[model samples]
Target: MSWYVYILKCSDNTYYTGVTKDLKRRVDEHNGDDKKAAKYTKSRRPVRLFWSEPHESRSSACQREAAIKRMKRTEKVALASRV
Candidate 1:
């Protein structure tokens, strides 16, 4: 199965990075008032997908998520724009 590394643009204009095997479900969780949503995203509801990259494995998706998390906002925005 394909894994995914994704960036979400939150209502507060901040970005969130995460990895998931099911992108659609994960995005829905972030936008919905569900227990599955990340705490960081829960308060910043109504997030929209800013960018996503597919990976062959969960490990790779996690690695990319980490890398993106470490990037500056400008850098992340640039990366998102390219997607």
Candidate 2:
């Protein structure tokens, strides 16, 4: 199965990083249009996908997402720019 590291830019201008096996469905959930929506994201309303990276394993995807989360806002912006 394909795992992915995804980033969402919340309506509040905050970014959320997560790992998921289904990128499209995950994004949809974050959008608060479904029952599976994350509580934190549901209140944030509209969220735009800022970046994504595919990984071969869930562990790798989670690690990558965590690494990205540790980055400074500028670095995150740069990373998003590169993507």
Candidate 3:
């Protein structure tokens, strides 16, 4: 199965990074009010998908997510623009 590292632009203009096996379902979870919604994203509701990159394995996707999370906001924005 394909894994993905995704970036979301929150309603407050902040960004969130995560990994998921199903991008659509994950995004839905982030946007929904359900228990699955991340606390960070739940408050920053109505987030839009800014970028996503595919990976062959979950480990790779998680690694990418960690790298993106460590990046400065400007760096993340630049990366997102290239996607």
Per-residue lDDT tens digits of candidate 3, residues 1-83? 89999999999999999999998999999999569989999889999899999999999899989998999999998997785
Candidate 1 lDDT over residue span 1-83, tens digit each: 99999999999999999999888999999998578899999999899988999999998888898988999999998997885
Ranking by lDDT: 3, 1, 2
* lDDT, candidate 2, 1-83, per-residue tens: 88999889999998888889988888987885667887778888799888998899988988898899899989988998995
Task: TM-score for candidate 3, please give it.
Answer: 0.95
lDDT of 1: 0.92
Candidate 1 Cα misplacement greater than 4 A, ranges: none
Q: How many backbone clashes does candidate 1 have?
A: 0
Query: Considering only N, C-alpha and C atoms within 3 Å, which residue pairs clash in candidate 3?
Result: none
Candidate 2 Cα outliers beyond 4 Å, as residue runs: none
Question: Candidate 3: where is the Cα deviation over 4 Å?
Answer: none
**What is the model-wide C-alpha lDDT for candidate 2?**
0.87
Q: State the lDDT at 36 in candidate 1.
A: 88
